[model samples]
Target: MEITEVSITPLEESRLKAYVNITFDEVFVIHGLRVIQGNHGMFVSMPARRLPDGSYKDIAHPITNAFRLKIQQVVLDAYKEIISENTLEKTEDQKQENVAVQ
Candidate 1:
């Protein structure tokens, strides 16, 4: 019932902020969760599949709002950490590039 692990991968595309994978109690794992920047700000999207009728269906989702919020908070925190790490790496790379140019 507790979240044991969370992994986030930042992306460069628009709207989509990152991809998330979470493990519960180190036994249950869910993949393909998304961190998205929506009109209302950041939110988590559950894993979904395209239905044959041209509609999308969630493959996995929490039944309760409280549970969903918990998952979202964990995933967003991980996403923020990844974003900061990526920013630091990019800054370092830019510094190296500047040195080379000098």
Candidate 2:
């Protein structure tokens, strides 16, 4: 998928809003993230939290070198696999004279 547009808006006294391109012509808005420090020797994790006022929170864990590399590899592999599959599907569709309407 191609990322055609992106927007980040910081709300006054509130969380930020992020808009991302879903597909070539599709877009989506993102809820802001809430980051927090973890226990045990600076251990970090992305976890859900309940605020003191009974509100939900999205806690983003800190990124370590190992974790970052792992995540990058995972994302790369998934994207490569998806692209290969999409290319093969497109080829097959062309062979079968099947055209998708945009």
Which candidate's lDDT is highest? 1
Clashing pairs for predicted structure model 1, backbone only:
none
Clashes of each: 0, 0
TM-scores of the candidates are 0.92, 0.37
- Roughly what TM-score does model 1 have, to 2 decimal places? 0.92
CA deviation > 4 Å runs, candidate 1: none
Reference-based TM-score, model 2: 0.37
lDDT of 2 by residue, 46-97 (tens): 2358999998665543246775444334433444455477679989988777
Worst 10 residues of 2 by lDDT: 14-23
